[model samples]
Target chain A: MTYVKPLPELTHEDRPFWEAAREHRFILPRCRDCGHIWFPPYSSCQKCLSFDREWIEASGRGTVWGYTIMCQPYVPGYADEMPYNVVLVELEEGPLLYSNLVGVPDEEIRPDIPVEAFFDDVTDDFTLIRFRPRNRTGE
Target chain B: MSKAEFSGRTAIVGIATSDFKALYGTDPERTREDLATHAIRDALDDAGLKKEQVDGLITGGTVHYEPLAYRAGLTDVRFCVDYPSAGRMCPMALMHAAQAVENGLANYVVLFNSLCFRSNQVKFGMGGGWMGTGLLYDSVYGMASPGAQYSLAFTRYQHLYGGTEEQLGAIPVAFRKHAQLNPVAIMQNSMTIEDYLAARYIAQPLRLFDYCLVNDGAVAYVVTSAERARDLKQKPVMIGGTAGRANFREWYVDLDFWADACASMKRDLMDPLGVGTDDIDSVQVYDNFSVSVLWGLEGFGFAPKGQGLEWIQDGRIELGGELPINTSGGMLSEAYLQGWNQHAESVRQLRGQAGPRQIPDCQRILYWGLSALPSASLLYVD
Candidate 1:
């Protein structure tokens, strides 16, 4: 089997983010002073510059804010995944996160479509957070 | 700043360009060099000067090609600068060149860009490395191409302000119709709102027609003080004012609704240029993607956020509308030389020399660099 490399290694600034994502939790920095969630996991809030922070779990349920169809595969190994959808998903909690939209037809993807979290296990150490169309089944 | 104005200081002394539609057919082909040669010659000829007279040069590249000063043979020039904002870099460089002339640092500055990307380049993945980083973050997650990046902006714009796809398509359709009068445009493919809406989606919310073409061409300009421009060959196109603004990171910021750089440009560029939205007689807002045109209009205060689409469709942005934008068909119709050619066209419009596509008494114009990182300049025929 061809091995798929996980996403780029996390830097010191964003290590908390990747560590939380490994456990299927979407983590963001909650400023102790301003009570705002920071994106890409920052150490301090630009608003208050407060170093005191807390990690919060996101609802992982949000609307499709915007997206791109990669007609050209960005990664050489993922050529077979040509025309996959990359999207900016606005989590219900208030942060805009980037991920691939899966399990749906390309034409059906539109603005404000509700989505829920899905994970990809590329390797033993890596599990990526992607999203798919919200459950349509009544159950 | 007292609202920067280009009124009577620096002028376009020369302009040059090569015929745009060349293709890179093979592996050893050098399309960048081809575009640079065309633009450098046209700009020098327009100014009635030679390569040896150039004291400053600025260029941008794709795929890590040869730099402009070296390839265009502007060697030994005192001021050499390269702007790598891709298509946006062209106008940014011109703004710098104009500043150099106004400051007495350079007598004549040449600004140029050669834009060409072959289909095979994508097929073989030859020059795809330039976008690899974007792929890792933005692209990897779905902001795949320029269309996708702009789509994110458009969506956020609609979320906050309410812009529709049909309204969004109006910007390109207006320019495409305007382009019909020019012979230089590539995608002369007749476009109507129906045609645009019916077109395939390159990225969600951005159809194929809504995107600008990747054509093979080059554009260039020579800037010098107004006093010396009179002695040159062509009518001096005065540089009224110039502004350059860049966002922190397009992917990080919501371009549609939250355009801080664009807002800064309005205060810094328009105030100093001494022209309000109504003062502009004609314009050449970059159309790298149609949404960019909308963002530029809103950013420049020509229209409010999300209302740019309505302004475009209501016949206000057409050739005979309140404002005539992209008279040389802009990047949508004529050539997408990384918006370098937009500057040359501004000079042509100000000179009343844009044959066949000329706007009557077209003076007092505004030229936007690109949408993502807003940069702008105002020029006039004084």
Candidate 2:
């Protein structure tokens, strides 16, 4: 089926990060001066405010920082996918990203569980990072 | 921390709010302007003043200030401005108005926030897709609404601090109890912990009751210099210290749950005001989501950091408890006038106009908007 959910409107600031994601490379902006890597990609380093920064690939491993089950499809295109989990993953590299938790039943999801990211190519133009349990029966 | 020069220099002299019971598709449905003009006239009447006396006009939430001033006959105003939408902007608006009143820029400032959900379909945290919230990220995963964002914050709060669903349910239940006393509160139905738990989730970790009411309503308050406010018909609620407002756009709430920031504001800004939480009689934390109140309690020092869930277990925040919170039902049961209603409730509380919900001998009230930026609070006293 075609991906009907909303897609991130590509912008000039974060194009490199998304383009890298398109290549199945989970990357984030890292400041050369401050050694800080942040998400939702900013043009400069969030910590040092220095425009001197570079995009670096992340480890794609993280724990479920927090999550909530969408009991209702408040917006369009998610009615069929009702009861899905909207999750925040705190990356091993120390940035938070919003994604869905797959390969784990909704009933079993809990906080601080080990998970690794996998690129789900929703459409030809975009690839979303989703997470699944490193061990299926892991807590 | 609020500017020292403007601290306690201005006062909220009169306040009024439109009825949310008359929502859209009901008889006498109101548009944005109708509600704005009505609230302006009523607030002026409440202050025992006339339209001609309004020298400053400040408005917010999609209500353009120029047209609103024209409708209210605030023709020659020294200060005429409008803030962008969102309940968080309410306290910031009050701050600017107080500065104007203190610096002699305006003798009287009439500030208001009016939102009509009936006429405009202001979607909740659902904006970032093409409109509000996120610029390029988040929406792709359907994480755009304020409720969705707050769900993450609340979930993180519990995971790091240790809390339970039953503990989370206590907030909405308490707000509903207070709403029962508010004559014009929208959600008059009684709520209990069981009811809160049984309620479905709009977003996980936070139940349906945790979200605020989105209704059509207008809240207006007349502001004046403290010297002028003393002569008004109503007992003025003097603006005291302010825990200066800050905007944190970080993807996740910091580990301290904003406690460190609140502490900095207290030490640098509010400490000089001489009236901390110890002197407060009532509290109105901006309850955009019931969790925001929990954040306020802990961040504002009412409860030990990371122990808000347990602190509110008793009736500490109820109408007659050690410290009353959201006595006018707040946004949960009260009409969601953005964050304006809480400020109005403080004014009402100090003036002994809250009726059955009134806190007796209430001389000092602390109201803050956790929903705005991380937080901003204005301490008001009679």
Candidate 3:
């Protein structure tokens, strides 16, 4: 795994999301008043418009929603990883996370495919959570 | 206000566009000049008015100032405004201009758009001082390409809807198929669902075909009172309703869905226009990306959340489907000149002037535009 520097500055609103990456935990915000979980950790819940929220750890289990196979290599750094599968994985908690699907061929990314998260240690500082197809084995 | 409240009042009296082509060779300022001039001439000819009659001008020039005054031949227009609002917000400017006219503040208003910067930089590497605000905080993430940002929504939609990748691929296939019939479309070749599914991915969840073609082109429109429309060459399609919307930010936030985009459009624009999605026979949806179209469809209540893929795959949005969308091939097949062509195409359909790709007896058109922002309009002819 290779480390990639985020091109933009990290703001206070999303600082927790990036900070959690160092500890290898996928963290998000949960409304303190309504008990609703928010992804990417916002200051308030879009539902009740309440600013009271807490950081909640997710189960990290979700299903592959939809994905696309990128042919053109626009970004110079990831050109070697051309035609990679980028997917949106829907967490059971209701927030959708944008991630890359690893350990699966580009053809396998479809709707409702069971998936789970695994950490990709790109570098000591930057660790990305990539999803992989869940195998139902020994049942 | 009611949707049809502006009936027999505001009308698009003029329309013009540049030669739709790749943006590699020409400078953005030159292309803007060509398109703005063409539109000005067309509007003057249709309205039977001279340059001196034009009193208002609005341009999407927030990033750069070259095209606003110097490039566009507007020497002494009374009211001139410029902003870096998203390309889709151009109609909001027109809506404002219409109200200005209704208030008797201006006689004639011009709205201009030029989309030639990206492809120019791609063909030849970007030179000094070409950065804009969108590239600042929004596209700061290296993975935040247009395709990548929209993929967040597409992924969530498919997760909630039970749609397969092949189903999502079907959208581009259908768009390209319709493009084959539109002579103005930049991409005229036939594409299939298999071809779409098989294409390589640009960002995760967004395939090569799922994105829009970036090219150099410009579009302009003139708005005048309905009282003055009958004196023009073509039948004036009345502007029934128009509204602009914005969220906290357009970047990839946690909740991929744009709730404001969904609610305000229904309450402020479409419902007031006296036409629901069913009442409108056709649409000129801004298809900047296949995913953006899906978002618009869901937000505009064309389909339920996550059901856009199924609606598209089941042929509900095809050319002859119950509701035909992007009849002008959309930005997906046509040039993505900031989605202004869709506005021009909607006017053509409303005037009964769309030659081959025209829908039969179409009296209403819903034009939806999306840049880094969202805005919509409903047009009708009686």
Identify the candidate with maximal lDDT.
2
Whole-model Cα lDDT of every candidate shown, in order = 0.69, 0.78, 0.68
Encode model 1's per-residue lDDT on B135-247: one tens digit a residue. 24442343444556676666667766776898887788888877777666665678888988988766566777776765566677788888888889999988776677665
Which is the winner by lDDT between candidate 1 and candidate 2? Answer: 2
Tens-digit per-residue lDDT, B234-278, candidate 2: 888887755554646543344455676666656655567676788
Q: What is the DockQ for all candidates, taken in turn?
A: 0.35, 0.55, 0.24
Two-chain DockQ for model 1: 0.35
Candidate 1 deviant stretches above 4 angstroms: A1-6, A9-16, A29-37, A41-64, A67-86, A92-94, A100-122, A131-139, B1-7, B22-30, B61-76, B119-135, B139-142, B159-163, B249-259, B370-372
Roughly what TM-score does model 2 have, to 2 decimal places? 0.93
Q: Which parts of model 2 are misplaced by more than 4 Å?
A: A135-139, B1-5, B24-29, B127-135, B251-254
Please identify which of the two predictions, 1 or 3, would achieve the higher DockQ against the true structure. 1
Top-down DockQ ranking = 2, 1, 3
Candidate 1 reference-contact recovery: 0.36
* C-alpha RMSD by candidate, in order: 4.3, 2.7, 5.3
TM-score, candidate 3, is 0.77
Question: Chain B TM-score of all predictions, in order?
Answer: 0.87, 0.93, 0.87
- lDDT tens digits, residues A1-139, model 1? 7655325455655677767777767777899888988665656775698988888877778878876665644454555766677677788777777777888887677777889887676556656788888864421
Task: Return the lDDT, model 3, position B319.
Answer: 72
Model 3 segments more than 4 A misplaced: A1-71, A85-121, A124-139, B1-4, B21-30, B62-67, B70-73, B122-142, B159-174, B177-181, B192-199, B203-206, B245-260, B294-321, B370-372
